[model samples]
Target: MRFDQQFLEDIRNRVSLSDVVGRRVTWDRRKSQPGKGDFWACCPFHSEKSPSFHVDERRNRYKCFGCGESGDHFKFLMETEGLSFPEAVEELASSAGISLPAPDPQAAFKAAKRNSLTDICEMAVRYFQQVLQSPAGRSAQEYVQRRGLSAETLSEFQFGFAPPGRDNLKTALLAKDVTEAELVEVGLLIKPEDGRPSYDRFRNRLMIPIHDERGRAVAFGGRTMDPDGQPKYLNSPETPIFHKGTMLFNVHRARKPAFDAGQAIVVEGYMDAIALSQVGIKGTVASLGTAFTEDQILRLWKFSDEPVICFDGDVAGISAAHRAVDRILPALTSGKSFQFAFLPDGQDPDDVINAGGVSAMYAEIERALPLSEVVWQRETSQARIDTPERKAALEKAVEDLVGTIKDERIQKRYRMDLRLKLSNLFYEESRRNRGPAQKGGGGGGWRNNKQGGDEDRASTARMEAPDTPAYGVERSFCTMCLMFPELFERHFERISQLTYSNELHSMFMTALVRIATDLAEGTVTQIYNKLDERFYKILQEAIVSSRPDEDSSKASTLQRWDTLTNRLQILKEDPPEDFVEHLFLNYADMLELRMLEMELEHETRAMEENLTEESWSRFQALKQDLTRRREDCLRDEQELAERGTKMKLNKAAMRG
Candidate 1:
């Protein structure tokens, strides 16, 4: 369904854009605009040397000068993180405390079908929970007890038991008025080729309800209590709501703590996540009975830049770590890091936590190796570098890995370090292989090949480098002004219309137009009061960037005021018919009158304090000028109102 623009704007008004962006980025406040109150951060949208991203709180919009990218909160989320429009809208709406409109009837119908399925799954979980308390579930209960799972852990993970009989779940769901179609859709009940009624898909097994991040139970994984079972563990097939690859078991409980801790511990199984949490390592997530996917890595990256992969220290565990390293390396750069931790042989996180304690687990985590070490070991170990061909192959592998890095400085550093290590290993290996006849050469063909590979790897690394730009302090100040409009308006006349590129100039001009319109409508205060968090951040950033100081002398202020009045007259010469244009003109005239009144008040106060003839004369002149300008402004306003009314009448007559 298409979300209306007004609804989107309402959501934007409630949610802070800075808060949302700040969750994923570190915002640096520029020193020059600290008092003005603006935030500056490197642009997340693109690579840049300095922060050119401007967020105008007064206007409730953000624009990046480097990329010419501008948008409201929803657009920012959609573009910055590559989320779907609906997803972006939903995220903002949740942040803004706004309820989404009901889906279309057609969409609602489909949603209801899914809800029906979810209801059946809920019934199944309840049924299994009840079964676990029954005599028939004695074996399942025994299995849990043997695993040393506490009652609290079991309940939190929704651990349950499927009854021994095949038709137990079917009868239970049917009793709850769940339709046969929904039971099949939820993957709890299976339909046979004979077109008969549903039967339990899982029987005589210990049940674990798999929940998504929202805590909605979408599927189940069942482990056999009896050794005679064909498959040791059975899981729900891919259904309407459950995709094994994307779902992370226990993420609903782990996400917040992980975000707060600035790290996430990824385990290999549901029990591992449950066990880790039971032992006080609460920030733990597990794959849903499958291997990790790139999508899962990306999702985890949203929460924390550092993710620790805790796997078994067996051959399979090593293999899994290698695979994870391969999947995660391309996404790794300056801001993010990954690590791999291998448990003692044949031990998973659950076994270690249960055997030693939480400290043991922490020790393991502390000893985790960096991703670079893992990659280097994995690549170098597999290659036979005794021959020139093998050395060339190893060099090529290193190049491929280095090429995956997006940051030039990081790539260069890693390449040099790896080359030195490889060179040392090659020299040692060559020395061992040398014979009496090869004394002069010392190292064999491998040593020469390694030397050549190291040079080539270093040369290949230099091919891709980053471009740098010269950042200007004035441009940064202008960005600050764009972010803080209240301060801009306070010193509007004093600000010089500095020369800038078309893009930066247009962004600043739009902000000025918005501020003028808001002031004219007598809604400037209301605008900030009602602004969304995102826009408020933009405003704060602008204010902080502009560095508006209040120290204007009476004479200089009045001269600037005259210049602004003249400019406003020109701006209003051919005002458009739109409400915004009329508002700007009105605000410009009011600003001029306000300045004149301030001057008159200052001069009058000075004359009273000094009681000098010259001061009295200056006060009289200022007062007269203020009175005449006020009258002239009032007349101009009246004329504009009359003209507007006449135009409206003319349009109405033409329509009639």
Candidate 2:
């Protein structure tokens, strides 16, 4: 079912875009603008030099100039991570605590088919768990014992056993009134040409239930006890409920601990994960015996920035690590890092912890090699450093590594380090270029004409670009305003007088007008009541510098009032769009101020004489007219806002 726009807007309101994306990308608060509370960061969707990615917290929208990507939270997830419509909806719903409505009649058939299949798989998991305790499960139990796994660990991992007979699961499922077609749909039973339905998967094997992050059993991986078994391992076929590429073994159980500890340990096999957990290393998970995928790495990063990869100290393990590094390098950022921990020869985490203690295993993990060094060593070993070919290869590798680093400061530092290393290597090559025969009498220094020429060209090319300040002047001004609102108040009149076409300037003027109207209404609370939540938050930050105390002096109050009045004057000089409504609101605000002043004057006049009937009648008529005008202005403002909403809808439709 498609979500309603209002419902989606509600979800956006609940979920902070900055908080959601900031976990993946490092974001720096941009200078605060008057009406806009926005942040900037390098776009994760594309590579760029300057941060052109803008996040509008108030509007709940994000736009990237480099990639031309713009969207709300759900669309961002779909585009950024390549998730399907329903998958994105499911994820956002789970995050936002929203429950999607059931599918319509058209979708009911497909939904029912999926539900039936999922029920079968869940039933299968339960059947296997129960069978593991039966007489038929003795061999499976013995296999677990041989592997040094305890009953508690087996239960925690949800290890199960399928009986040897082909019809065993079928018979059990049939006894529960489950149909043949339903079992076939779940990949448990296969349909033969003879029109008979029979089990074709997992016979006489130990079943390991594969769970999603929600702890739901979606599929299984079965291992055979018989050495002569046709297949060593059998995995569940793809169904609506499971996708192997997206699933990480034991993640359902490991996520909480990993998040709590601020790191996750990724292993190669399910056994390695189980072994580590049994020995008190609970934050471990394994890919489903496949290559490390970008999607899997993103999922891992969602829980923590640092994930330690533990591989067996073997040729296959080393090869896997190299592949992982190549796949994951482009996804890394400055704040995010990875490490590798290689076990001893012919050993795994299970063996290490069993032979030694958990502390000993922890020490090995603590000494894990950083991801950068691992990448460098692997690249360097593939070629000879003394040759020109090797030097070129090194330069390319360094460039690749530096390019992948998202943070500008970190990338620059890495580039400098790489240049130094290359320079040293080149110096050694230059020394070797000169023959040893001329060294004793008069040393012939090696001249690298090609290298010197290339360096000169590179330096000349670099001089073409002008240096720009990291933070622009406008941004600096906005940040200063946010940090010290009182200072902003002091210079408010000057700020209001300035005019500009930029978004920052427009937003600031909007905020200043709103603040002026609020101050004229007497109390800050009255001003907030008239404004939307988004504008209110901006005003709160713009005005409240330090807390007001009961002992605040009259002079301090007058100074604050004067500062605010000046800021309002400057903002009014060059008003933003909707200046007409702002003027109307300001007029009504003046009426309220006048009424207060007149009421005080009338109180003082009461001592001179009882007010005459004519004077009282005139006073009441004036008050009524003022009230009527104020209400008329309020009605006009609401009508204008409604028109603006309609205009936005029309614009969206036209674009679509």
TM per candidate comes to 0.58, 0.53
lDDT of 2 by residue, 612-638 (tens): 777677666666666776676577657
- In candidate 1, what are the lDDT values of residues 1-656, reduced to their tens digit? 67887898788777776666666556665522434335567666544546877766556677778667787777776544445578788878887888999989999888887777776788788888998988888988888898889999888888899878878888777777877777877788889989776688998889999886667888998988879996877889999888888877887788767766666899887878888898777888888766678778877765566688898988898898888876776666554667788788988886787777787888788667667667776776556777756765676677678778766656644554454344434543443477533221211222123323322222221211112121122233343344323334445564433333334333544554454544324222233334332232223232222211112242233222112222233322222323323434454445555657767878877776788888887888887888887787788667667765665666456334
lDDT of 2: 0.63
> CA RMSD for every model?
23.1, 22.4
Q: Report how far residue 140 has shifted in candidate 1, in Å.
A: 2.2
lDDT measured at residue 428 in model 2 versus the true structure, 0 to 100: 33
Local distance difference test, each candidate? 0.63, 0.63
* Model 1: how far residue 534 lies from native, Å: 56
Residue pairs with backbone atoms closer than 3 Å in model 2 (clashes): 492-567, 493-566, 493-567, 496-570, 496-571, 497-570
Cα deviation of 435, candidate 2, in Å: 12
Give lDDT: candidate 2, residue 551. 24
